[model samples]
Target: MQFHLSFPISPLVPGIQHNQQLMLMGSCFAEEVGAQLTDHRFNTIINPNGILFNPLSITRALTSYLDGKLYTESDLFQHQDIWHSWQHHSRFSGLSKEAVLQQINQSQTTAIKAVEKLDWLIITLGSAHAYTLKENSQIVGNCHKVPASNFDKRLLTVEEIVTSLDNVMHRLFFRNRKVNILYTVSPVRYVRDGVVENNLSKAILLQAVHHLVNKFNRLYYFPAYELVIDDLRDYRFYKEDLVHPNEQAIQYVWEHVTKYCISPDSQELIKEIAEIRKAAAHKPFNPESEKHILFLKRYEDKVRKLMILYPQIDFQPLLLSFIR
Candidate 1:
């Protein structure tokens, strides 16, 4: 007599939940999403290393992250001003350029340390095209004062992106085995780049990221592109420039991401944090305690640093006047 044996199917494993610490990088759009996560009380780090404006910058930052040499500056001038000048054509001469370069080098150590402890990494691909410097063949963040004759425009291919991402992933995994990756194609459009080339570039990135996610089990793709294009489906969701998504669009994207990735426990935690914030907002201020005085002093110090870094910023004068 032949006997048939019955076998039971294995239970489905639950999807990965998001109580883990998150680090975000890539384009400016990633910053928007990161801000929302922080506001919601998620353990999200925005550009903990620093903002990366091009592929070469990304490579350098990743190298620093692996080598444990990212930069950290209490002064905003050391961090933002130099980069802003380079982007805005405010730095035209050799002296100014050298200063910016030096600042970038100094920050490498702090950037590395910030990324070392991250459990999740989210990268947003903004553009496949970049401008490379003529002398050193390095990619520049923006085409500011660098003469038009001193640069070459190059559009990166799908293969190049995949290779770069693979290298980044390898480095992160080497440093820490448990790091997982999430990639999103930025929904922001390149309004200045001709329509055809712009669309073509975005399409290439979308396809490349999709392929990469499929190839690696630990790497995942969130459909920010679909949410903007298919779900929102309205031009009004964009900013005045018709390039970046408006606040409403960003809010929707953030909500969708947290709903899918965040754990139930984490959501509960966020709710508790929100209640605390609300209660704090309603409470009257008391200045008698030592702890309260110390907290106030620390906040004052932060404001002082901001004033020095951004002298022309309107709030600096306002804050100074208030303190005085």
Candidate 2:
């Protein structure tokens, strides 16, 4: 007997293959999926501007690259003896202004390079709520721990989100005509916003995605939000913070994403790569035992065979691990 309801998913006629390039942005959930794709040897660029939650910020990041925007010392501010940008995640913060701008410019350049060959672009919208800097009236991608009084908090209307998405799509296609776009609403709960507000925020994002999906022929929506709310409707699926989905819930959502979004041949290849990774990561109890050596030989053989079958799959890093 079926225990829980599953979200209805229509498979993309032919989903992403291993050889294609993927770019994912918006929210930490996008990072999680991108990490999985990377682990399986898919070429993917994830969150070049770091984890941007809202559509406006994500669009800003995309436009920054396409428009060739560069960061300068003026774009950064001293925060707790370090330099940081409101447009970037705190991970880019550094002790020197030159370092911060260097990193930010490097990331923007990397994104522009990646966009040229981008095959599938997946964007995850986490929230519709945004913070606008009071001084310049600019919506900051991140607040950078600035005082609350310096910013005006607001939730973007469905129209605004749709417009941001439309501009992003238009710019993306203008640069790359062959790219397929996918969008998803992150399942991470925004408890800090209060329950009702959080629901409203998510609803706005969902509505915007639906509108965009219907408008664009190549755009697709993945029901990651619905899977968490309807399928894994239990507190056990969340972390101690009761906000982010735990490993179990993420795995559940990932299975659905794989089934609906990955090509059949690539699915089998992912399985093989998973086995290779497991073998590579195995720790031997007897470091010099003959049996262990035999296992290593078999492991190397597996890697060799897999590489011969899929020449694009690189095993050099793992192979070099045994050299010294």
Highest-TM-score candidate: 2
The global Cα lDDT (0 to 1) of model 2 is 0.88
lDDT of 1 by residue, 83-146 (tens): 4332212232134445645555445444566566767888887788878768868666556544
Cα lDDT for residue 275, model 1?
47
- Model 1 misplaced stretches (Cα beyond 4 Å): 1-19, 48-50, 53-56, 69-107, 275-324
Per-residue lDDT tens digits for candidate 2, residues 16-95, read 99889889999998998888888888888889999999899999998888887888888898868988888899889989
Candidate 1: lDDT of 315? 33
Residue 271 shift from truth in candidate 1, angstroms: 3.3
> Lowest-lDDT window of 10 residues in candidate 2?
315-324
How large an RMSD does model 1 have? 11.9
Point to the candidate with the largest lDDT: 2
